[model samples]
Target: MIYAGLDVGSRTIKLVIFDTVVKESLITETGANPLRRCREILAGRKLRRLVVTGYGRHLVASTQGGKVVSEIRAFAVGARYLLPDCQGVIDIGGQDCKVVRLSMEGDVLKFEMNDRCAAGTGKFLEVMAHTLEADIGAIGDLALTASRKITINSLCTVFAESEVVSLIGRGEETAAIALALHEAIATRVATMARRVGIKGKAVFAGGASLNRCLVRLLGEKLGIELTVPDSPQLVGALGAALLAKHEDGQ
Candidate 1:
């Protein structure tokens, strides 16, 4: 029997199929219609069990017929699978940032999120990068070489963009602006980690985990080296698929 996990995120949909061994993994843009995109992604797949997760989990479960798991649960499981000694998990996705502390047994102890806001998420960085006329990923490289961190007063996306414009007008270096923006998010996420009591190396997952600037900034802020999976963005889906594989009577 085959097991599958589907993560329907705000910006992308990730799928993982497995049973003892991973058979396939894929990611595609969420686009305008997630349901439609999901259907397109699963056109000819067969599975004995399916697990759905992420913000759009309920929407997909109702229409697509699958069990649902919270992002927190799935992430913990995935992190542990990749790094058995994982003490924490941080996911910086398109719409929100999440931090979770875990037990050695892979159970979720505590978690925190940004209240359904785009304050320090991938979407927030995308917007800031556009306003700065810089490549989102490339700016991280620039930020690394910058010496000073420009203070980003507001975490709000709109106001931050305005702030970026004013900085540009003032002729502030783009790298400084990038560092400031990255600092804002890294600082906020680190605070959440502290609240959850995550003091050791944590698993950094989700799309934003790909941002080198965020990785370095977050690691420095937390004062701990972070661990990232080979396929960080698929961690949630991978966990869900593994869970489905373990479900009885599959």
Candidate 2:
């Protein structure tokens, strides 16, 4: 069967087309408008089922005649499918951070999320990248080469930008400051994960999970090796696809 999943995230929309019988999947990302982009992507596809998940799940759910699943559930389902031993998931997106505790069967046992601020989200890194005049993709490599550890006093993106400026004025290298920013963000996210009671064999997902610096810092703070999906950003969509597959069996 051909199943389609749409993840309508705050900053971007993701689509996944899966051939369940063959266990193959195709993923794509577009702007935040999931309804429009989903229709555009599904135009020529012959999908037998569809499911939606993520921040804007309800918005696309109605249009696609599909059910809305929580991002935590979807992420856990997708992560565990790819890494069956995964017992925890940490997802840091554009606007929030989520930590989900999962059972051996891939069910969500407990979860915690921080949607109240931009401090620990991908936006934090984006703002910092702009302030440092550094490429977001290169930030990780630059951070890895830092000679010293600088403290970032503020977790607020605006305040952090100001702190970065002050550090630059004090002759601190951009690489060091950037590394500190990533470490600060990782600390916040690690705290959230701890609140949910993280276990070993954790999986990190979402757009920010692709940031090597943040992932490395997260691993260090959590003191656990994290499994990253082949396409970290597509976990939600993959989970949605898995949901569609289940519904078809019913």
- The lDDT of model 1 is 0.88
Per-candidate TM equals 0.96, 0.94
User: lDDT of all the models against the reference?
Assistant: 0.88, 0.85
What's every prediction's RMSD, in angstroms? Answer: 1.3, 1.7
lDDT per residue for candidate 1 within 1-250, as digits (tens), equals 7899999998899999997788899999999899999888877888788899998999888877889999888888888889888889999998888999988777888999874778878889899889988887787887887778779999888898899999999999888998999898888888888998886768999988888989988898888769988899999999889888777454
TM-score, structure 2 vs. true: 0.94
List clash counts for every candidate, in order.
0, 0
Give the poorly placed runs of model 2, Cα more than 4 Å off. 21-32
Question: Over 4 Å off in model 1, which ranges?
Answer: none
| Leading candidate by TM-score | 1
RMSD of 2: 1.7
